[model samples]
Target: MKLKGIHHVSAITGTAAGNVDFYTKVLGMRLVKKTVNQDDTSVYHLFYGDERGNPGTELTFFEFPNAWRSRPGTSSISSVSLRVPGDAALNYWHHRFVQYEVDHDDITERAGRLTLAFRDPEGQRLMLVSDEHDTGIAGGKPWVKADVPAEYGIVGLGPVQLTVSRAERTERVLTQLMGYTKKGQYASAIAGQPDIVVYETGEGGSGTEIHLEERSDLPQERQGIGAVHHVAFRVDDEAELRAWIDRVGAAGLAHSGFVDRFYFKSLYFREASGILFELATDGPGFDTDESLDALGESLALPPFLEPHRARIEAGLRPIGTGSPS
Candidate 1:
């Protein structure tokens, strides 16, 4: 079974309220799920996506209140890209970022596509890639009620960049163990470095790519706020995910097998370079527990966590009211 494109990318955020404001109010993605981190029930896990929280569209965060800013280096998920409709959409977002005082670079080309690089208030590295010439895996429809016009709204996730010290080791895992095909290479933004390699999985396109940058120049990253925790790739269903679990095991890689994350099933593993990767199913999505109109209005808990809802709610500071103090 071939792995689909990206499922979601989970990152760290210092404050749930501010994260909510930036992603929802500024970026205009729908706050599709307000929940607690399953592994650590006390903290908030917020998910932003297209209207229905489709598989490739989700961008999630695990809140660690007052966390330190991340120290960027090698062996990290360096940058996360969001897909926009066209070149005109890139121009629209450039003006929007300026108006909102968002820190951003001028629109530039990367891998034959126009892109706009920027950071969140907490310095999360992000790029908006234009899909004007894309013809592979399709992007999701933007949330209709978002402040940004639908035509220019962020649709889904694009290529995720992995910065690692040992690119060959990670490349082996991707091509040999994980079934990603080496697509091509592109020039690195950093001067005098080797070209960044590109890999793609099922239905190759922007959404299915992993841009790998090999750097001998930086130390290991210390993850805190604004750093990506892991990136997950999409699986068609539970059966396909189960097959993948077996495949990962056959490769002798240590993994968390058959994790039933109520919204989806998952298998987590790290490549040779220590970057976290997850294979996640696409079904039993966000709307399974909540109706479409009421998503993210209140905290959601899986069936197992329902018993401790009161205790969990007591620990979290309220979000969406205003900025956290």
Candidate 2:
């Protein structure tokens, strides 16, 4: 029972509308699903991804209208990475960021790949990694209708960075429990700190990597706007996910066992360092309720929530899909 690469990364946003604009308009990702947080049923849970909202391509956000800006520190999903076509794509994005006034850094190499680091208006940390040398799990196709050219559009998720106070504890959970192999380590961007270690699972590549950064100089992160909620890795289906639930339970880790998310089944558990990790299925995808042609154009709910659509819609402020006007 091996885990696939990243399924999706979910983060917190304060304004659903602005989140929509930045991710869809600026990043050129398709707003693949417009849904409410199933647990809450009040605020928005927006999903953005490549053309069809494929498994590894998804990046989601939960809207908490009044959430305070996040405090950057250890014990957090510090940085999220997006995959682009190649080095040239990074140059395209750098120029585009300038045109759109997006906060970003000059293109630089990280872990032997060209990357452009940037943040959303809300200060959600992100980097676009070049897939030029990538050869593991393949990336997703770009949305055909996106304003950004297909060659230069963001493709799928890359290695996610986890900053923790106790790296060895998290490393044990990753290697001993989760079956990730320690690939290598890189010099941390911060001086006087230990090197950030790299870990990978199924079909090792940028998409399948986790860059673990150990930072003792910072405080524990408080979840608020611009903070990551959880990072999910892909499992093939429900049967595999159930097997994983059993494995996690055997390890004595507390977990949310076998949740039916409608689109995909999931098993959630927090690792030793307090970072939430979810094992999610790759199918019964975004097209389950909505058609490929009209995805994210309207609000979607699971069958159970369909009965409360009116009440749910009433509580949400409209965050129009498609290109921003």
Candidate 3:
């Protein structure tokens, strides 16, 4: 079975309010889900995406107050990228970033596409790539309240850059185990910057890439605020997920087998260079709990956590976005 594309990228954040403001107000993504981290109920697990909170559209964060800041180096997801519609969309974002005083770089081309790079308030590195040819995961509706019009709104995920100690083992895991095919290669325009090797899903665009940058001399990355914890890849269903479970078991890789995430089923594993990866299914989407119009309006708890909802609600710091519809 072929892996569909990227499901979501989960990262760490220090303040839930900062996460909400930057993602919703500046980036214009809808805060589709406001839930607590299932494993740690006190912290918030915020999900941002296009209108429906579709699988490939998600960029999630776990907000742990007073956490250590992430120090970037090797074996970490260095940056998360989002896909926008075209050159016009890129221009619109450039103006928006300027108006909001968001730190950003001038538009640049990589892999033959225009990109606008920037950072979130929490110091998470992010970019907006103009993918006019990406029809794969472009179907999500834009948020109604977004400052930018729906026509020029951000669509879904783009290529994610991961810094690694060695590229060979990571390349094998991506190709042989994860089903990504090498697409292209480019040396950074800046001297001493590691060469970027592009890998795409079988589908080949939008939310379907793992760009490996080899920095063998750098120290291992430590995860905290502003760090990407894991990258989740999409599979079609349990049938496809089962195929992966079998494959990872046969390969003797460390993996979390079939975790029922309520909204989706998850299978997590780490690559040879210690980059965390997950295989996730696309069914039972974010609409499972809330209606399309009312998503992210209230806190949502999984069934098992329902009994402890009172304690969980009391513990989480209030995220004061007031219905991110």
Candidate 4:
């Protein structure tokens, strides 16, 4: 199958309001939509990303007010590394994190770039790597205008590393099923460090990846707020998505039936080894609500939810991606 790229990355979260605020105000992500969890109505599902909350740029969250914390283990995939522009951009973000008191780590060079480590409301380890090769696709905070040069802004998602106990199951799905070939060892995860072995979609680093590290010492990861809910790879359309579904079924694995997610169609399934996986179609994007110039100002709903707009709107908790309460 021809997987285009990463559609989006979703994670679990606790305080829905607080989580929304952090991604928007603190991280400068635009809140594109607000909706109650389709499966669990009391909770929320918030989306944050660049202008219009474009695909790949999105960082989605699911609210679980009183949920157990999942232990970080070798079984699940976590840690999404965002590809930022350069070392100078890293410095700008470092000061910004301090201003917001978000508790981010100091600058360090690793894996051939400068990176800053930090946590969300739920202790999911997330980082920003300074990369010079971006396609100039980015969105900033409302108050923070475009200051740094285009080269310093975020380009795309860098690499998504999964901490798995064993790589056999996931590796088979990656190399044999998907079209990722084995690339060699990654360098120290610090700035000015060597590059690590990277397996990408045909072209290196352009698509979603399964960066594996075997760790016997680490325990299995629990599905808690702040933990990754799933990693979605892009498909050309619904047909391609169905093909992937067929492949998973043929492999004799269980999967969540296909569901319409408005911007893109999606299906969920756990890899044989571990880690929640999603195949998303990359069309009918975020332009449905508002426009390229004005997005996230109003609530957006999928077609099914539109019929019950009154009830849906009333039931949904009012929140934005900025100004944490």
1-325, model 2: which lDDT tens digit per residue?
Answer: 8988999999999999999889888899999999989999889899999999999999999999888889988879999999999999999999999999999999999888999999999999999999999889999999989889999998999999999998999999999998999998999988899999999999999898999999989999988998999999999999999999999999999999899999999999999999999999999999999999999988889999999888898888877554221
Angstrom error of the Cα, residue 314, model 2: value is: 0.7
Q: Write the per-residue lDDT of candidate 1 for residues 35-75, one digit (tens) a residue.
A: 98999987899999999999999999999987788999998
After TM-score superposition, the amount by which residue 96's alpha carbon in candidate 1 deviates from its true location, in angstroms, is: 0.6
- lDDT for model 4, please: 0.68
Q: Candidate 3: misplaced stretches above 4 Å?
A: 135-139, 321-325
Candidate 2 vs 3: which has more TM-score: 2
Candidate 3 C-alpha lDDT tens digits along 1-325: 7888889999999999888988998888998999989889889999999988998889999988888988889989998899887878999989988899988999988877889999877788999988775545454667878887987887788899989888898999999877789988888664786779998875677578888898856788878998999999989888889889999989889888889888898898899998899999998888888898888889998889989988888787777745321
Clashes within 3 Å, all models in order: 0, 0, 0, 17
lDDT by candidate, in order shown: 0.93, 0.93, 0.86, 0.68
Displacement of the residue 260 alpha carbon in candidate 2, Å: 0.6
TM-score of each: 0.98, 0.98, 0.96, 0.86
Candidate 3, poorest ten consecutive residues by summed lDDT: 316-325
lDDT of 4 by residue, 1-325 (tens): 8665577888888777788667765666667766657777566777776655656677788888788887787667668876665678888888877877776898876554568888775687788876644322332323233343444555456567776766666778777776767755565344553333456673355335546665656678777866888888878888888888888788777888778877788888887676788888877777765586655556666667667667666655556443211
Worst 10 residues of 2 by lDDT: 316-325
lDDT of 3: 0.86
Candidate 2 C-alpha RMSD relative to the actual structure: 1.9
